[model samples]
Target: MSFKGEQHPGVQAPTPDSQGFRLNHTMLRIKDPEKALAFYTRVFGMQVMRRLDFDEMGFSLYFLAKLDENEQVPEEQGERTVWTFRQRGLLELTHNWGTETQADFAYHDGNAEPQGFGHICFSVPDLEAAEAWFDANEVEFVKRSDQGKMKDVVFVKDVDGYWIEVVQADRLSALGD
Candidate 1:
């Protein structure tokens, strides 16, 4: 059966030649690195897999990932860079230097006006527990799971006002259909 639209005869999906093609990371610019790092690490339990500082460019890049409990990150910079690039589903936070000192500094969260980039999402094992944790931590909620028509999903705002969709991993199949 044709899905979405009719497919032309003798046409097939194009496949990449290489084997290890994976999404490296999604980057988000933040006003404060410390606040962004704290939220991703303390709230979501993601680790700082690697950090790259550009003193000349006046910026820093922090790559965070939800690694396995026992997975050890390489200590050396070169090894860690390779290891980080190998991992999938990474979040890269870019922090420009000296923005933290400005009281009115803010990044365009991509939710207002133009609204180009939507939001990043996380699938949790326990939706209720995650929601409870978010509430306990005083995270700003754009839409709670129970509040919206899609009752199984929740959207929360980060320190930089970026929307993060949180959903139950087990219910993903049902949600997809």
Candidate 2:
């Protein structure tokens, strides 16, 4: 399928076994789960749907999502876990046992020398309101809506210094230009 104006010639329809495949989640290794979770939940209005602790592995996974209108998270652990796995656009934060106490611990945010993973984006209903919200919350701005050539899109950094792009998606058609 063609994406935006770029099409990979080698890309084609999924094979039978992959017919129903979907992007389930993207994982980001975090040094401190508490700060990361607070940033995502309080600033972006996301909620923790489920969490899995792998004590043997010395790491834990936290699944969070900004629910759609009228969407409800399952109250039971078994059902919540199943629902979480089935949903799309999940942000999974992986916390290793003791990274939080390490003074110099950091993760590659993928925007430096060997840029790989770029960023995650959030679509807001009102661009102006979102900007004000970010300002009120003292969120670090990588690029503010009015700062650059793009007029209505904004970018902010999380506690981990990961880029989170914010935009009024209704105006996204112009971005394709």
Candidate 3:
């Protein structure tokens, strides 16, 4: 699969296919880029791998990752500080200058109505341990369960109310095979 003249990763060049296109990042507008970055880094244990500035647009983008989930960082201060990008998954935190506001969406607080889009999902190896962490940390979990062959799933909200889905990767496989 390819698209827009960009060759698909496993397909021949010079032509794009729609099926080859994949998600690069999920962009979210935040009230404070610095605060959001810190929250994600400290809570999820993700590190800022790269940042790009759009001076003309007055916005900035950041890339983050888990310490051991990717390749070794060239110069990390400690074991837990060596986050890297193992795959294409990324969170794009954008800050628009002088807005002091966040767009109404899954990341924002807009009553109990989910507004269609509601959460970002992450896979963890252990359901019990992850749920315990959320409970001990006082994070509000929307749901939790072990669905037999489907995999154990848990949902939690961060400090700013962004919902996160934690599940076993095996759950995704069960749906197909």
Candidate 4:
């Protein structure tokens, strides 16, 4: 539904046209799919659900869980694409046309002074275990739960320098601390 906090006076009671609206995916412009895909799938357990390439456009990739290799998937490409869009909690990473060749290409990770887009978050089943795993894997951290102003949250950075907030939804009480 709506984001946390009560809807403001002007935005209360969503309009009829927004009835079926859903956030299909939040996209990030990545410089290299190889590095980005490895981090997401290896670290977060996401799989490459679908790969869409526009003839005129550079990139359109959707990552999520797909049927196991032994399982049968839709034979038609169109059907596969539809399956990806219909699923919930999608994270799409797109690479520009020629960024692959540029060794120094990078995105303006939105955490800078003129911040607009903040970060995307993931909820783990166990907060303590997740933090340990991240530590073992050397995932860069913006702040750790123990040292931060907040008690039970972790902020990490992706290959593209985007901040990823990790949390345990069950421990809602620790957030305010």
Candidate 5:
């Protein structure tokens, strides 16, 4: 099907490719790695699949994933690196050295005047329960599930002010063909 603004005669719909490709991960620059890591792990129940520190480059890459209940992360660096790449829906947090020390340091969360990148999303089993948990934990909310036009949808801000969309997984399944 053609999308809006793609009515040009020369433009053709994209055909599915047979390549064995998949979305690896999405990276977000974080001012404070410690705080960001805690927020993601404690609030979202994500674990650190792998951590690569580039001391020479003055930065670090942290790969996090929400693993299955029985899944265990590899202890070896090599094994962890390989395993991290194989997982889907991973979140990469990049931390530049010394940024955490600066009192006035902050990253562009892409929600200001010149907005570019929007937000990342998470599907939970229960929207109301998740919303209550967030509220109890004192997490900042940009928009609640019952707010505005979008019912049963939530938008929360991370420590770095990045927006995260939360929705009910059951609701998603209901909308699927």
Candidate 6:
């Protein structure tokens, strides 16, 4: 069978390439991109790689990266972008001015316990130090236990009320062999 809007005569369909698939970045709609950017930069220490203004769309898009990989840093310079020393993952902040700019996604849902989408998680070195950093910044967290293999996890929220998990493990072996 032939696909729609195609002018090929007895040609085989092109197969999709799946050899090198990797996560590029994650995008999230934020009520306030400015506040979210600040929270991620100051608290999580993510670096803003590039922020482009879409005049047509009437919104601003911010691309942030974990500051550890110097090579992955965007070569673009100038703009209201901030970068920090966190090398875990990339966070994309989308700010929509005209429409409703908000989210109610939680990372986890356990048996009808006020569940939505849950949260994002990151591994840190010291739990005490990490908790202290958030505490100093007037951030609140809920320590999580009974996580099966992964215990001693702490739950925190960003400026936009997004859940974030902070996990600490002493040695590599502790994560399981």
Clashing residue pairs, backbone N/CA/C < 3 A, model 4: none
Model 4 lDDT per residue over 1-177, tens place:
456456666766667887787877788988888888989998888887788777577666655552346855565888978877876678888877679789887889998979889999998889889888888888999988777577788899988899999989987764452
Which residue pairs overlap in candidate 1's backbone? none
TM-score of 6: 0.65
User: Residue by residue across 1-177, what tens digits does model 1's lDDT show?
Assistant: 456454789866646675568889999999989999999999999989889999999999999999887888889999999999988899999999999999998988899989889999999999999999999999999999889678889999999999999999777666643
Note the Cα lDDT for every prediction shown. 0.91, 0.91, 0.66, 0.81, 0.90, 0.67
lDDT, candidate 6, 79-146, per-residue tens: 22333223336777888774343355332222136775667777788877888898899886655433
- TM-score of predicted model 2? 0.92
Write candidate 2's Cα lDDT for 1-177 as tens digits: 555354578866656997778999999899999999999999999999999999999999999999988998789999999999999999999999899999999999989769999999999999899888988999999998888888788989999989999988788786854
Tell how far residue 66 is off in model 5, in angstroms: 0.5
Local lDDT at 94 for model 4: 82
Better of 2 and 5 by TM-score: 2
**What's the residue-level lDDT of 50 in candidate 3?**
70
* Structural RMSD, model 3: 7.5
Clashes of each: 0, 0, 5, 0, 0, 10
> Among all windows of ten consecutive residues in candidate 3, which has the lowest summed lDDT?
77-86
Report the poorest 10 consecutive residues by lDDT, candidate 5.
1-10
Higher-ranked by TM-score: 1 or 5: 1
Q: Which candidate wins on TM-score? A: 2
Runs in model 2 deviating more than 4 A are 1-8
TM-score on alpha carbons, each prediction: 0.89, 0.92, 0.63, 0.85, 0.87, 0.65
The C-alpha RMSD of each candidate to the native structure, in angstroms, is 3.7, 2.4, 7.5, 3.5, 4.2, 10.3
What tens digits encode model 5's per-residue C-alpha lDDT throughout 52-114? 999899999999998889987778899889988987899999999999999999988888979
